[model samples]
Target: MELEGKVVVITGGSSGIGLATARMLLEKGATVVSWSRSRPKISHPDFYFFECDVRHEHSVWAAYEQTEERLRQNISVLINNAGLGIQGALDTMSPKDWLTMMDTNVNGIFYCTRLVLPGMKRMREGHIINVSSIAGIMGSENLTGYCASKFAVRGLSEALYKEVRDYGVKVTCLYPGSTDTGFFDNFEGVTSRENMMQPQDIAATIVHALQSPPNFHHVNIEVRPLMPKGPKSPKKA
Candidate 1:
């Protein structure tokens, strides 16, 4: 389907890939709505921001209502891009931290997807893109909760494709490796921000998937920097 004039809702649109995707979608003439706790830094006539904490069902419902009422259009695309990262040893991790991560990374997607799906199914046309991560595909040390949440997203993508494809709704799951984002602000051990992929790169890929033929489904996409770390220099003696 053509992107022009389409309405897209992106979660976590305040920054990172979500923000980049919003800008790119607007450039394609698509109406964009950003759902996040913080306000976006940019502005456009076609861009709309809804302060929402997707982890809560009521918040999502309200946001959905406002989006539809304001735009007077059912969403053509829903991007489950909001995510939280809380990494630590399993034993060291607190229950609150674990719940918060799942609430943001998994439940938020769940709440958002459920609210928009009925309309999409009724329209018999829509796209749902869930952003997973490389962690979802591979386990990482001290990242049990994060990995579990991403894996859940991957599972949702897999199941939803089979469940919704017959209704003319396309489902895509993205598994991206380390990117230069605030996701790593509280963590350490990354090789270099310069070596990671940029948000715009992911944004372009998302638009490409959306532009695919109706019969085609990108399904799952896994992207990473070819060289995530530079070659090591000689060590000091």
Candidate 2:
């Protein structure tokens, strides 16, 4: 879809990949609406920030309602990027941590997608991008809850893609690996940022998917950093 003057709604747009995407889309002339628990730092004439918690259905609905009332436009794109992770072994992971990951990663996407589908169906054209993780594709040692939630996102995206394609709507599942974001701050395992992908790189990929020609669509994109060389040996020692 041509991005000019389009209405794009992004979840978790306060920072990181979502923030980068909002900036990029705005540069292409799209009006950007960001929904998050905290206010985004962006200030643009075409940018609207809505404080929302996507895990709650009512909050998500209210955000959409306000967007329509204020912008007077149906959303042309929906980016489900609000998610959190708590990495740990299954047995050691707290129940609260598990619920938090599931609610934020899986239920949040569901609520936001549910609210946007009706508008997209009415317009008969839209794009939905769900940000999953490499853990969604491959299981990891200490990230059971995180992996489960992401895997659910993958399944949900694929099923929704099949259901919505007939309505001229496209659904894409993005599996990004080891990006240089605060996502690692709460992680329980060791994390290395030696050769991590930048948030802008993922944002560019998302824009590319949205810019696909009318005749084609991208269903899934998996991105990862090249394997970093091992640290040099301590030969002097």
Candidate 3:
């Protein structure tokens, strides 16, 4: 599909992967719409930002309506990139924190995808990318809630593609490795932030996927840096 003048909506466009992807897409000549609770520090003629909290269905729906109304165009692509992570044992986790993680990581995707699917199906041409985590593939200690949410995303993406493929819509579930995007801010002492993948790395992969042939259906792609830094790393390396 041509990226030129394509309408792409990205959640959490204020920072990290979403921000990087938004900038990259804009560079590719795609009109970018940012749906984020926090405003982004981006300035471009083709770039627009809308304040949205994806956790609430109404908030997502309203933002979608307003964005399309303003652009006067149907979304050609959707990136459910807004995600939150809380690391704790279930018994030690607070209800508020857990809910925040679940709502942001899982429910947000549901709401955003739901709002855009009918339009995408009607158009019979669209792409949806759901950002999961490596934890979604492998469980980790003291990170059960975060893992569960990412795993749910994997499941959703797997089922989503089968449901939408015949309609010419593509669904991709991305499992990205630890990136130094303040995603580690919630964890006290885990890994060296400088040793992880960069947001631009993930952003580049997303752009490459978008540049694929129209018939190409990317079901799931896992990206990890070589010699990934773990919770306990030797100082020498």
Candidate 4:
């Protein structure tokens, strides 16, 4: 679909991949409505901002309503990018942490998708991209809650893709390798802060998928950095 003049809504737009994507989409001539709980310094004429918590249904609904009121158009693209991570072994993690991860990573996608579908159905065209993670596809030692939540998101986005493809709505779940984002702020590890994908690279892939033709339903895409084949080297070359 052509992004020019399209109304696209992205969550977690204050920083990281979402903010980068919003900037790129705006450059491509799309009207961007970015939602974040915390505001950022934005200076784009075509970009609109909405402060929202995706975990809250009321906040999600209110943000969308405000988008419609401002743009006078149903959303052509919905990017569910808001997520948080908590790191700990399953036995060590608190119940509160698990619930928080589930609510934000899993249920938040459901809430936003449920709210956006009716509008897409009425319009008969839309794209939904769920930003999953490599953790969603693989298991890790200390990230039990985070892995579970992202895995559920991957499953939800896949199932929803099958259900919505014939309706002119495309659903894609992107599994990005760890990127330099606040996503690692909760984790403590040697490799957590480095040796991962870049947010701009992921954002470029998203724009490519969004612009793909309807005949190409390239649904689930997993992106990871290429690891060295040789023995441990001092530097990556």
Candidate 5:
């Protein structure tokens, strides 16, 4: 669909990928509404900011409702980017932390998607982009809970893609690896921010997916850094 003047809703828009996406979408002539628990200072005239906690169903509903009323348009695109990361060995991680991961990453997507489905079906045209992670595709040693949550997110995206394809809605899932975002602060291991992907890069990919032709529905895209080759053995001795 043409992005010009289209209304797009993005969750977790205070920072990271969502923020970057909001800016990019604005550049593409889309009217963008961004939701977060804390509102960030965005300077764009076309960008509307909404404070919302996606983990709470009411918060998600209110944000969308307000956006719809103000914009006078059902959302043409919904980007599910609200996520949390809790890192530790599964045995060492607290039950609360595990539940937090599931609530924010899994249940949050479920709530937002459920609210948007009706409008999308009625219009017979919409896009849903769920931000997953490389950990969703490959397991990590200390990030068991996070991995599980992201894996569930990817699964949900796939299921929704199948269910919504018949309704003229496109569902795209993204698996970005170790992005240089707040997510790294939760990890206990060494983190080189420079080595990881940037939020802007992932946001660009999301926009590309949004612009993709209807005949080419890229349901899933896995993004990762180039793997380092092993050290040469002393030049073959």
Candidate 6:
């Protein structure tokens, strides 16, 4: 779909990938609405900020409703970028932490997607982009809960893709690997930001996906950094 003058809704737009995406989309002439619990640091004439907690259905509904009412148009794109990652061994993980991860990463997407689908279906032209992670594709030792949440996102995106294809609403699941964001701040595993992809890189990929012809749909995209090879070990004396 053409981006100019289109209405786009993005969750978790306060920072990181979501914020970067909002800037990029705005540059393309799309009207951008950002939903998050906290206010984002961006200010643009075409950018609208809505405080919302995607984990709650009512909050998600209100955010979308207000956007539609204000814009008087159906959303052209819905980007589910709000998520949380808690890393720890399964036995060491707290139930509250587990629930938080599931609620934010899994249920949040469901709430936002459910609210946006009817509008897109009515218009028969829209795109839904879910920001998942490479952890969803492969299991890691310390990311059991995080993996579970992201894996659920992958499943939800895949099923929703097939369900919405006939309606002219495309679904794209982004599985980005180790981007240099605060997502790794509380992570217990080793973090090498120097070798990680930048948030702008993911934003560019998302813009590229959105720029695809209406006839083409990219169901899934995985992005990873090109890490330099470690030095070879010398022969033992």
Cα deviation of 28 in candidate 1 (Å)?
A: 0.4
Model 2 root-mean-square deviation: 2.6
What lDDT tens digits, residue by residue, belong to model 2 across residues 28-115?
Answer: 9999999999888888999998889988888988898899899998899999999888878999999999999998999999988888
Q: What lDDT does each candidate get?
A: 0.93, 0.91, 0.91, 0.86, 0.87, 0.91
TM-score of model 2 relative to the true fold? 0.94
Candidate 2: where is the Cα deviation over 4 Å? Answer: 188-191, 229-237
Best by TM-score: 1
- How accurate locally is residue 156 in candidate 5, as Cα lDDT from 0 to 100? 93
Cα RMSD of all models vs. native, in order, equals: 2.5, 2.6, 2.8, 2.7, 2.3, 2.4
> Model 4, stretches more than 4 Å misplaced?
192-194, 228-237
Predicted candidate 3 versus true structure: per-residue lDDT over 17-124, tens digit per residue: 999999999999999999999988889999998889998988998899899889998898999999988889989999898889899999999999988899889999
Error of 1 at 133 (Å): 0.3
Please list the residue runs of candidate 6 whose C-alpha ends up more than 4 Å from where it truly belongs after superposition: 228-237
* lDDT digits (tens) for residues 1-237 of candidate 1: 798999999999999999999999999999999999998887899999989998899999899989988999889999999998987989999999999989999999999998889889999899999999999999999999999999999998899899999999999999999999999999977667899999999999999999999999999999998878866788999
lDDT of 4 by residue, 82-161 (tens): 99988889998999999999988988888788988888877778999999999999999998999999999888988998
lDDT of 6 by residue, 131-207 (tens): 99999899988889999999999999999999999999999999999888889887675556778888899999999
Question: Over the stretch 116-203, how does candidate 5's per-residue lDDT look in tens digits?
Answer: 8899999989999999898889898988999999999889998989998998999999999767888777557654567777889998
- The best-first sequence of candidates by TM-score reads 1, 3, 6, 2, 5, 4
Best by lDDT: 1
Worst 10 residues of 6 by lDDT: 224-233
TM-scores, all candidates, are 0.96, 0.94, 0.95, 0.93, 0.93, 0.94
| Model 6 steric clash pairs | none
Candidate 3 residue-wise lDDT at 98:
85
Q: Tally clashing residue pairs in candidate 2.
A: 0
Q: How does residue 231 of candidate 2 score in lDDT?
A: 58
